[model samples]
Target: MATIAPIEYFDEADFDPFVIDDDVFGEIEDPYAIFDRARANGPVQPGTILELLGAPADSIVAGIPQFRVIGHAEVQAVMRNAALFSNDVLKMNLGVTFGDTISAMNPPKHTQVRGLFQSTFMPKQVAKWSETLVDPVVNDLIGRFIGDGRAELVEQFAKRYPFEIIYRQLGLPQRDVQTFHRLAVTLTFNSDYIRYGKEASRKLGVYFQNLLEERRRNPADDLVSLLGQLGGDNGLSDETIVSFFRGLINAAGDTTYRATGCMLMALLENPEQLEAVRQDRSLVPLVLEETLRWNGPIIFTQRMVMQDTELGGVRMPAGAIVNVSMAAANNDPAVHENPRKFDLFRGTKSHFGFGLGPHMCLGQHLARLEMSRALNAILDRLPGLRFDPDMPKPTVKGGLMRTPRDIHVLFDPS
Candidate 1:
């Protein structure tokens, strides 16, 4: 296993504290309410209030006229029309944190990078990892807490399990997983605290740079080694490799934990649904999909207009920033009935939980595999799983990436 020395700290004083305002951070107690209002007024609604109130300083829509796409069809149209609505918004806002990633690129470039990375996460590869890597890791995590009558699922299990899986795949030593997790949290979730996020991003860049160099010198059976071997000939520069790794860490570490945490909260809140899944384990996938539709982690995604275009009969100027509200679209009455209700039996439907179009989440398969395995392990190993009555109930919150802050649950001690 390769080991890189950790950076003690990065200077954040030079970093601007507020690139975007707090209101723009989208930290709403009930995003659905805002989405409902937007949808009621029109599928495409002006976002002046959101911009003036709390848009992040780095927000692409900060000074420009902004619009929100709330209707399901409208959101899909915007997502699918990657040419008209480019992903440059992410590049503009998060270039420093994520570098020139696939999410920020368009067309040929996005295709090249995405194609190279896609093989790493192919369905067969993911299934192999699920059986060999995911199952053991989840079982081990459960074993650590099963003796206790109660456990805080977020801190103890939800956060660590998926992160560890990613770390192992990257071939990093087990000792460094927690360190990477800490840096990832600051990079992904602490964007509101720009100074901290910048510092974390800086350190993470250094960490990956060193790791890539190490892999180049001494080959290993890991993603980093595979990427390193690709070299500049394939358009995989050291800087690009480091950036891709940073993006992967952020996606794998941050999104999975939050999404899984939200899933547990959904099941706990709906005891009958929980019991139903427990009775028939096959329903786990449906429950996961429903949780994503009803209360997915990502609230919205921003896109920059590449050319003048019209959506929902409203004309949008080139360079306008559009906020595609996946959460709202998932709940749109025109698409799903009683969209707010969490129903495992809703059957599979289209959702932006993994996003859509060219820049859709690449690690979605891995995420599902980890989630299903974790859910199954908990059900098999920990009998009678239910929320602990003595503990405060967990609630899903956050404007950008929402998940339960904590899930206190009690189960039969095995």
Candidate 2:
């Protein structure tokens, strides 16, 4: 990794790291409406979702023969048949920004990379972290404004806890939390901000390289130490380790941050549902599943067609870019009754929110554990939590990512 000046400070005035910039890809107030129309046309369409929506195509996938897969079955088919549809599309785009991590690789390599830490992220293991990590971090964040009676949940709590949990798990310095947060966001949308993404990747790579070395000498009980201790024939190179670290920060932060905000916004908009969950804590999982289906953090995922194939009666040629619309599949009326409604009582749990098949989200268990703890903490500490009617109503919007940027609410101080 190229050396850069020590990243000691981040200016707070230039931009708010917690908020997603609409300009990154071009914001759409109702991307789902566009997806619905596209799906209505045909489950598998010739053009990309951007073109179908009349928006500009991302430069990365521009000029390529792109197809939009919208039906639940079609999207599932593409995601499940990794042999026919490869994830190498990410290699050309996210690979440059996130490094050559597991997210960009195919079987064998992807399997091995994911296996190194799969045991750590398993559901059984993640549940154990709630008491040791989630509860304290969540309670401390809530305590910051428990007496204020009103607060901006996004800026104050939702944005902070997810990164804090992941940073602590890696034994990262608490002081550099803001720096890492900024870098993670930049790397995520690197295509939008090319120069900054390159710089952020280099900075984070250097930071991780230094930490890896320290862990090598001191051997602490942390994720970084585990990565550092690997040796013999199966050992990983520093470049791969740094790449995995960069991917970890990128994966561990954004989805949870946006999903938490989305969940709160969903509940705040529907007071009856919020009250129901508060009364029946068992319904908390339903709230999360419904939120993910109604407005998942990731709007879509991309795959490369490996061989000529027909899906939903649409013929796709080899090397075509397939934009699998998860948001569309989740809200498909065929699979979900009254799909648009944010019903916490909805029974069907089938959706591609965390994706499916070989490359399913490895951090899903941890993400769920974090969101569950945060939601429960808010309900317990903030009595009568509801949208601040005097403030602007929060709306979830984005071209690819979906979440309310801010959710102002009022609660009883007592």
Candidate 3:
């Protein structure tokens, strides 16, 4: 047998964190203030928030046009009305990079493609994975750093956990995890990272193509095999299957890592809440939900106007881009009491963190399982977990996909 060539890894050192301007997305310290001002204007705010970051009105960032929506009701309306507000903005801008992904598809096609993998992520399967996969991954990762007394959770734990789960679930070789991580970050984080994103996309395409062929010849009990078996009857073309895998890999890997990091940061910043959840393990899910509301991994998603429509009393032309700010909606005072506060006791409420409507996140159940397990494991293994006072406190950043840049912390060694 010919030896398979090892995947070339992207050097993390090559990318300078300082080179990316914090202001690229505007004051990361408090974007809620900006969201508040936009909400005040009306439900449907015109112009992209990137303008606040000094981008020109017409410029495209990561293939997204300049438009903004902050109202909770209005954002929900846009998300619900997929027919009027098409989700193919990425396809329109990025060409065929995503193929006919569920995120970029509409109606009958989206329904058909989404149904194929729906069972895989159902609550029952998610629960099985939680016990069999998520718990073990979380525990092992924490075990690696537990004895060190101090660790940067982002690099050491949060980033690696979800990537490993998704890679294994997809039946990809473990050797490619680092490459996938770098590619996922570049694709999801910033528009300035577009060039790298395209390169990553290209590499992933080749990688998936080979994987797809292997799965076709020799099926297995994994996502790639399931997709390969879908065939002609399910309305999934070979190209669509490849794109779906690409989209899944990107979504599954990127969002969970950031969401977990954000949740930890929320707890760390509010030590009282951290202790409350630590003491009462059942509160972990509530804290996770609240973190989604307060600081979701995806700040906003773009929708293109399919026809002339009036939203939030503002007239919009066909083809106009509308930015649906999930972060803003999560903080809407109308729906949430004291929306700005991070209260785990806030109880059940709707949130767009995993998105809403037809294109709602497919991996949300899996994400919730992974986060719940990871957070619970951290608290169990590392008692008295607190931010390292000697090190710089981590701050949430990015206007598009917000998360703590780093999470430096110390825990009781004993």
Cα RMSD (angstroms) for every candidate in the order listed: 3.3, 2.5, 2.8
Q: How much lDDT does candidate 3 score? A: 0.77
Q: What TM-score do all the candidates reach, one by one?
A: 0.92, 0.95, 0.92
lDDT of 1 at 1: 36
Candidates' lDDT values, in order? 0.79, 0.82, 0.77
Worst 10 residues of 1 by lDDT: 15-24
Kindly report which residue stretches of model 2 are placed more than 4 angstroms away from their true locations once superposed: 1-20
TM-score quality measure for candidate 3: 0.92
* Model 3: pairs clashing at backbone N, Cα or C within 3 Å: none
Tens digits of lDDT, candidate 2, 1-414: 122234543333465444447767456778877777766688888888777666656887777899989999999999998889998999887888778777888987777877875777899988988999889899999998999999999989988899889888887765678878888877767455666667778888878888888777777778888767653366567878788888878777778888999999989889998998888889888888888888988878899999999999989899999999999999888888888889988765888889999899888899889999999999888999998989998999777777787899999995
Deviation in Å, model 2, residue 77 alpha carbon? 0.3
Which candidate model has the greater TM-score, 1 or 3? Answer: 1
Distance from true location, Cα of 196 in model 2, Å:
1.3
Q: Regarding TM-score, does 1 or 2 come out ahead?
A: 2
- Model 2 is weakest, by summed lDDT over 10 consecutive residues, at 1-10
